[model samples]
Target: MSTRTAELLASIALIVFSLGLMWTVHTDGLKIGWVPERGPGSGVWPFWLSLGMALTSLWTLVRWFRRTTPESRNEAPYIESDRFGLVAISFIALTAMIFLVAIVGTYISIALFLGFYMRFVGKHSWPMTSATVLGAVISIYFLFEWQLSKYLPKGLPMFEDGFLWLDNFRWEYFM
Candidate 1:
């Protein structure tokens, strides 16, 4: 598809998605207004953000209809033939990582994704790729599981058991 057609379709999709998000937030019983003394309600930010997104999407649609934006006027293919391979590779890698999250866990999946992307796609040195993957996994573990106390998906039973053992070891020795 052409860039202009892609932009038009994207804008319309965004508008619909934003409106749906707003509606869902409103229906979840979280007040989307200022509370009496507690300040902004729980749904206030999400509702307002979605509203803003919808408004911006509407503006984009208007611009598209008027052909006022350069993207709206451009008739070039959305994905050029030269860049299609890279794009397809990236998409497939991402899909594989997401799928792996259910089998190998979030951290392992993320590490694999980073390693593959950095070493192959980015053509980075092995040391740099290893450092990046390690740092990312450690940081994510510390930030989410440690500080925020939010347990991410740990994949299958074996992986979950391994993580549980690690957590216990940390609590016993470090904490």
Candidate 2:
């Protein structure tokens, strides 16, 4: 209804989702190592995050309840009416990018998301958008793909094998 109400609702929703996610992660074998390594389990991060969310939500709920006055109750909207559309669209774009992660690889999705945000939402010139997107892609390519040697999620096994096949191609013969 109001900004405070909306934020309280959103916080409650996040608290519930985080708790559920933590439970799921805990049930699905949090720790990979047993005795020697004593590394953090899969649920470790989520568990702590969930705890924080729960505490924050409780605090917000308490504060909102305590701040109940006639004037405070009828405060201005949480977000400006004119900015709602832009905010909603930006949130939708972010959610769409997350959903697309399993469809396309991270690199392609990141590129597409950046292009959409920069050119469409941000209203930047085409040249600026193109340059920024290219720079981001190249930087990520060098960072994770080359320097860190971390393999990002490639969606499915068939796609992974396809990339592997392409990667194994020797360029020395052609050179």
Measured by TM-score, the strongest candidate is: 1
- lDDT by residue (1-175, candidate 1, tens digit) is 8999999999999999999999999889989998998999999999999999999999999999999999999999999989999999999999999999999999999999999999999999999999999999999999999999899999999889999998999889987
TM-score of each: 0.62, 0.58
Clashes of 1: 0
lDDT against the true structure, per candidate, is: 0.96, 0.74
lDDT of each residue in 90-124, candidate 2, tens digit only: 99988988887787767677888999999999999
Off by over 4 Å in 2: 7-74, 156-162, 169-175
